[model samples]
Target: MDIEDLHSWPDSVEEAEALQERLRDRVREEPGPAVVRTVAGLDVAYGSHSDEAVAAAVVVLDAATLRVVESAVAVERPSFPYVPGLFAFRELPALLSALRKLRATPDLLVCDGHGRAHFRRFGLACHLGLLTGLPAVGVGKTFLVGEHVEPGRERGSFTDLVHEGEVVGRTLRTQTGVKPVYVSVGHRVDLDTATRHVLALSPSYRLPETTRQSDRLSRAALRERESDPASAPPPAAAPRGR
Candidate 1:
């Protein structure tokens, strides 16, 4: 894997924050197209060695016939460590590469992570959306950043996720009697729109079908690498500002 030389990385937390601001932007809502054609999901996981990570992108049919269409995977060394609010720096390099390899561009991206529910309101999903200039949503299994009252144990129930007294995202009950997933705007999409998309994409599960497929695909790719190290794709060129 070819990772950018970040040995001389940001000297302090303030510097990292400044750099984040320079590369980031606030999330916005988008009026998605009525006719949905394609939807993509992104998920990442560590390799068997735990030294490398495999990021996968999967596009699926969005109409009544939901089926897997295209998929891609990339491997890269983790960057920026595993800090709470800095996962993008560790994962996006590989994730971006996997996304670029996709043959189809979906109307929406369901990211397996957080978005506005972050410190700078630019979580992994938001960062990826801004970096790729695509419409994306953050669907996190765990709350990374945000506060919210629990939604009722019923499908479609929701409550606002607040941070510092400002609305940032939502806790959505995708499935009745199951824990809800956190929904947030990644980029070019509003929280309401994001929630709606998540609901539409979810046919019969707690998480959207696209994201669940991506999560499975990503982990499978990592398993493949474990079974055969020779098949792993090289990481992209060192990203700028690394």
Candidate 2:
């Protein structure tokens, strides 16, 4: 779970955006692992009282059984500002810390955010995949940037999400009669493979099991940090842009 030191932490919005543009070229839009035995879900939960407090969680699950195999959590204050397109800068540090604590190296990473579907096409998933050198997919709860037709009511149905006339992702229906989730290529995963993985992971819920489980764990960790103030880490210095 060692992450590559890709670049220094950006100090401003301009620096972050420039970094994204540079790293976007490194993203490989290819098929992911054919046999995924373990998949890790990544998510972050924020404190209700303080905007700075946050918890990042990584839950590795058995791909076939959909049960957690290993889990880790990191609680820290966000250093980057909350800009719309630069959220990865805010969450990546804590998420990477959590990932480093995991004993099991996941075959695939399912992030609770956008990938190629973002305005810059280098969302959290892409950033994470590049740093970790792991195949990753982005499953967003809401649309970030795209125009797409509504998918069919049946599960597995999907429509192309077009952005700037390019097929960036898919509006996938993971469950029958449920609001579709957005599936985008993170790093080495193609759109089709990403869609199939997402559908398989979400057997009975609108969101994938990876996302659901990680979400719950992140919230629980945040609650733990809130209840015991002494456990909270010192606040990160606010990035210059903020």
- Indicate which candidate wins on lDDT: 2
What is each predicted model's overall lDDT from 0 to 1? Answer: 0.74, 0.90
Estimate, for each residue in 1-242, the C-alpha lDDT of model 2 and write its tens digit.
Answer: 67887787889999999999999999998875889999999999989844568799999999999999999998888888889988898888789889989986899999999999999899999999999999999999999998999999999999999999999999999889899999999999899889989989999999999999999999999988889968866677532212
The residue ranges of model 1 lying beyond 4 angstroms of the native Cα positions read 1-15, 229-237, 240-242
Tens digits of per-residue lDDT for model 1, 149-173: 9999989999999999989899999
- In model 2, the Cα lDDT at residue 112 comes to 98
lDDT, candidate 1, equals 0.74
What is candidate 2's CA lDDT for residue 147? 97
Per-prediction TM-score:
0.86, 0.96
lDDT accuracy of residue 238 in candidate 1 = 47
Residue pairs with backbone overlap in model 2: none
